[model samples]
Target chain A: MKVIREKPAVIQRPHNFCAGCSHGVFYRLIQECVEELGYSKRQIIAMGVGCNCNLTLSKIDTVDKFQCAHGRAAASATGIKRMRPDLLVMTYQGDGDCGVIGLGETLNAAYRNEKITVFTVNNLNFGMTGGQMSWTTLEGQKTATSVRGRDCAATGYPIHLPEIIAGQFRPAYAARCAVYDPKTVAQAKKYIRRALEAQINGEGYAIVELLGICPTNWGMSPVQAIEHLQKKALQEYPLGEFAGGEQAELAFLRQEAEK
Target chain B: MQMAKKIMMKGNVAAAEAAIRGGAEFFAGYPITPSTETLETLSFRMPEEGRVFIQAENEIASINMVLGAAACGARAFTTSSGPGMALKQEGFSYAARMELPYVVMNVQRWGVGLGMLDSGQVDYLRDTRAGGNGDYRHIVYAPDSVQELVDDLYEAFDVSQKYRMGVLILSEGYLGQMMEAVELPPFKEIRRPDWGLDGTGEVGLKQLCPTYNMALAHELLPVRQERINRVCREMQRWESVETEDADYVLVAFGLPARVCVDAVRRLREEGCKVGLIRPKLVFPFPYDAFHRVNPNVRGFISVETNDLGQMVQDVALAAKRELPQRNVPVYCYTHSAGVPRVQDVVRYYRSVLDGAVKEVY
Candidate 1:
């Protein structure tokens, strides 16, 4: 018999994430990409607050990881990468950790074009904290605090961080991908690999926003949550690379001027 | 005897150069009053020495950067003042809990919330105790002058890693800005600790804290207590002047201590038995020096530059602990924001001698 599929050495045991949650899937995808791209031994992850820290309990067998303070993973990764440029530094954060409280740190890291990778799990709400309304929570979505449903007029619209980062700042790579289905999961894997390669090539900062479905938080079955993420969340956060191309931003500027 | 080369420079620049001499490879900080020179000097000096230096967007980012560097076992630090240091308490607490070694030079400003830029000792209580949340203690060094500032900061890295804890250089605005002739320490090459996360997964998995650390907290309590006790036992340092057979002793640190030295001399010349005890290490409180003071000492005067006198309470505690048999009176004299005037400190001592002022403790 031939070996068709096997778990990477980076992931030594089953993760402790909720059943049917996309966090474990994205975790496996990242480990697989790290194993595939040959950075299995030389990558450091600055893990942020929120469910991202839950990965610490997953018994990651190898690869260095620092559970950074809330909202400061990008800044911490800056120090790790700056002190030792030989190592690949990355940040794993949640929507609340990266797009809300850490907006300043995340944006400043990109503004400086620090040579690091950022992977944010956008599950629409703050999952680990009993499903509070997060920066990425869509309008009309009900959360713990927004029990009446998120009112855009009052709470404002969902923040598109990757879009904001890619549209304004100059990163080496910036893309958003969903993991609700097999094809989308494969697409997420490619974006994850591209973000990793961007750092390995020393091109500069790279970011990939992974859209995850929190079935427990969304109060839906695994199947229903997947459909909701695809049907509703996808509209607010489109999947594509927001940053890339030779002088596309300049072209965008000139085209805006003409319009 | 060989003479070390001496140069005249400001305290902030001296701290920056001394950090480099102390084997500090990374520095992250935001520009704030008095302490800004340290950040400014290192901006160019770090890259010139092939080291890392970043002017982060804010103090939160700066201290977290220091945390990351220290997590990698690299000697790193950040410089800030009162408000900025308050901003850094979270990162400081994280570094303390992680048992990571780093240093912070807090050139203190007086008051709260966008405090004045003048020199003061308002942070004396906060820096010696836990500045952030939780029950943890880090080493605090108080220097009286520019030369002492250079010396303390030079040895900060060694002392921090020796105990695997953070170190705070409790500097004052006057001391950080004043120019003085000082001999900088020699540039020493030290090896980074091997237990840090090198990011080479070739080694065993190094979880840089919290989950496993939280689990280990119960087991780590006694270890932390013993470590702190050991630090307190071995790291007590201070200057004792005419403390033998004196009737009263003047206790102070940093810039205020400089004036206390003068007050002590003037009092001694006037047929008075006033002595001086200047603590070099504020956290340990120099209880050992208090122990060796005149047994017949009538009172202890604490000179400070902050409102309501912060260090006076510590002075009272040390006095009460060292001489438990009798109730000793502790008087406080605060110059508020600026440096204490020599005459004011002397007059305050006179008032204490005359029993015109009430004892605070």
Candidate 2:
């Protein structure tokens, strides 16, 4: 017998995203999770502005997808979750979409502990909008709008969303992952899986912020961008779990179920 | 079968009861004059009925919460007056863009600022045409009587859900505060759509919320235009009284519309040919229906209670386009900063009919 292999569910066509953009890798990881968890058929992927908006055109099997107004994907996701709680719901948003325009809805959802997962790709700049500085834009990063390196004194510091959400809402599972290298990509997969698992267990809100690399926007080659992310960005945004006592809670529930 | 009971109730209370009878499961709002009773009534009744009722941090939060709940497949609603309505505009626009079905009751008071908590239909301009951003249209109902208010509430929810759009119930301070007889309807269980975000277990579906998408915007213009066209085609309704033989048409809505009816009767008694055309759905503004009336009408007297003549402009535009050569003069009688009485509208109608009044744009 011959075995036929295929690309991961996350990989799709009309790939207009610039080369070395982490969006493709993140998409693959998310698709893989849905396939592994048996949620593929019951999942609805909400794709928001920036690079993630391309997900709407992607042909991901068993996952219905739609696009919403900029910065409002979280609120739409909230509506979707309320309307169809049985489906595995997730939103693919960028830093500008999640951290800026959608800040209110995002924070409110976390506070309310809505049962949904938000996969936020924080590349420090609004990559899709001609590399403008975003809420998560690194202090010294240069972009189209910020011709001079980002001024922390004048523009305020980068918003550490995971830390803010963890401090305030304490969601079921919250973590920051990176996609700078193969190892971090694997680590990001774990965090994404954990967040989805939390939703499956009816634990609460889960958010995974991936510190991705936007090579084109950053004015660096793909390899150099990865190295830059590892050397510069990683220091400011350390990877780790920020909230959710879900691991302990899940264990307790399992014990009780066994009993 | 249970017989419906008729009782006099304030417009706001009737609006609240209508929401409950319409199977509204979640309500979030902040207290504002003339509209506070809606939140108060829901706060007590919702919990008792196993519905979710919350007093949100502010008008913005309240609308957002309702949007959240409505997205989750609950029949959701909120109520407010002028200033609060202004604050809720952003959320309202998002709700429309996302295509969430819910009810918003604006118990109107004078505005542009901190206009007194008096009965006024000035919000007609803001709420009717484009209270929110985008080219999307909202299903609007202006109720004069408490019964009409209740009836409109039920219809508003049905229209909202069927069309996947926001519905506005435009009432005024007088309607919100005045007591009137209303017949109560039996409660029915609301069957939520499979798409709402109640929780993970109930519907076995993912909660979808609205997000901004620039890529979609590239192709959004045509798609949005089509939606607006469909809305215009399907959702326009109007009510007219003594329009046949009358030479003058009085255009109004909500309490002002009710006053126009009295003005029409008085004008007829004074041997002037006058009639009234009341718009039930303000957004898909009933232009075609208004055009069907006799063009022999001399002019239209727009009675509004706002300083800025908003709805009057819509009426004038409609009249000019529809009945261009009826010698139709558009007269604006604005009770700026106050509600116009029936006698005041009758006086305006008489002047317009007798050709004694100089048209004020």
Query: Which candidate leads in DockQ?
Result: 1
Position B129, candidate 2: lDDT = 67
DockQ of 1: 0.68
Clashing pairs in 1: A41-B201
Interface RMSD of each: 1.5, 5.9
Q: How does residue B53 of candidate 2 score in lDDT?
A: 76
Cα lDDT of model 2 by residue, B273-358, tens digit: 88888888778788886677776877777788887677878887788778866547788888765567888887776666577877
Pick out the ten consecutive residues of candidate 2 chain B with the lowest summed lDDT. Answer: B199-208
> Alpha-carbon error at B67 in model 1, in Å?
0.8
Predicted candidate 1 versus true structure: per-residue lDDT over A1-259, tens digit per residue:
9999998877777778887888888878888998898877888899899987878767656668887889999999999999879888999999999999999999999999999999999999999989999989999999998999999899888999888888898898899988877889888898888888889888899999998999999999999998898889999999988875324557878899999
Q: Compare the candidates by TM-score and give the number of the best one.
A: 1
> How high is the lDDT of residue A35 in model 2?
77
Using lDDT as the measure, the top candidate is: 1
Q: Cα lDDT of model 1 overall? A: 0.88
